[model samples]
Target: MAPKAAVLVPCLLSLLLPFSSLALTQDICVANLLLPDTPSGYPCKPKPAVTADDFHSMALAQAGPTLAPFNTGLATATVKQFPGVNGLGLAATRVDVHVGGVVPLHSHPEGSELLFVFKGSMTAGFISAESNEVYVKEVREGELFVFPQGLLHFQYNTGNETAVGFAAYSSDNPGLQITDYALFGNTLTAEDAREQGHLRRKIGGDEAQGLLRIAEILKLIKVFFGLSAVPPDGRQDYRCSLLWTCGV
Candidate 1:
């Protein structure tokens, strides 16, 4: 009888082990990332198969290339190339801006962005025409800043050494709208782009183009903010939609 009992106990333990493991992973989430092993890279595997090892890389500690301001913040490991960012819409990595390197004035319309300083100093800000204010702020190592979505913003390296930092965006596919890139490249009118007390200072006139795109983007954004309606006459009444709306 004792020998029979020992064999039965082993079988029972095996049966229960699978159940315990399943219960542990019932509601956990994971991002699948593809890490590059060469000068170029490959793609991500399935998300469920990803280990924590794929999500964290210490490559930012390596010596940087001579690409100057834009080259240092190498995003070769970003969400676009890695599948971990697919559904979450959040991705980040490090940056190294040489002294006097400027990230220039830009905004990410799809989401808010923050830069965490690993080393060095810089200035950052956002300009809101509707709010009629510039939200410029300075930051150094161990500091951070948040730029609200759709606001025009910029960052400049102020450190004697190369400025290094971690940049995180709220979206995996964040749209980078540089103030200067928008105004001059497009066919938008300056008269149509003017704000209450502001005419764009030319970043090749892309600032004007950047501001022009805001009207429609902000309108959609307004809807999510609980604004009742976007008036038909191109005006911002902010009134609750009465009777009906083009929105419905």
Candidate 2:
């Protein structure tokens, strides 16, 4: 990666470092991300211009959403309020489904969804009516699919053209809580999962099994995102169990 040449600011680093060093390290430091509100969209700061660097730390838009690997387009709203997202009530995002594509089944144990199809034909639905656990369905565009909290759902491409969709969720980090992921590809081993079915946690030392499972998820996430391990002192759960760190 090339070194950034800096975003032509009017202030001297020597002078502002004492007063604005906080902007570089603090989350919710609105010195930058929250662009000045204006009548026509956001007004650019007239001086002390902001660059992609300003939002890079907390937003995925730094990379301009997915161009590949996603097999379709992806954009996130968590990236918008991230520096201040902690404890916030909601988050939103958009994902485009390509022709002959499918969104693998998943659930948000902590959130629900309201997806609106904006273009092309698509089939989207989620588990509804707890009694039989049926998924309510919607076909064609300009329609909606609402998944009650904790229900599994999926969307499939059904049109000749690419399908565009918007997904709104209730949590900041709504990961792929697919049954397979939680049961197999996660931070819990088969033994650990077995214990979960009982009323109490099994008390015993199977250190190797526990370590192996956590390592599996952590290592995979690290390789996927090209990250080093989370720092030891205050890290929790997975590298992305979510965070709100400050002054630690």
Model 2 scores a TM of 0.46
The CA lDDT at 200 in model 2 is 32
**Candidate 1 TM-score versus the reference:** 0.50
Model 2 per-residue lDDT tens digits across residues 59-120: 33322343322235666766244433422335676767776555655787767878888778
How many pairs of residues collide in each model?
8, 0
User: What C-alpha lDDT, on a 0 to 100 scale, does residue 47 get in candidate 1?
Assistant: 51
Please list the C-alpha lDDT of all candidates, in the order they appear: 0.56, 0.53
Clashing residue pairs in candidate 2, if any? none
Clashes of 1: 8
Per-candidate TM equals 0.50, 0.46
Task: Residues 106-224, candidate 1: write the lDDT tens digits.
Answer: 67777677789877777777788697687777788899988776678766665678877777877655667655435433454334555611466543455665676675555544443
Clashes of 2: 0
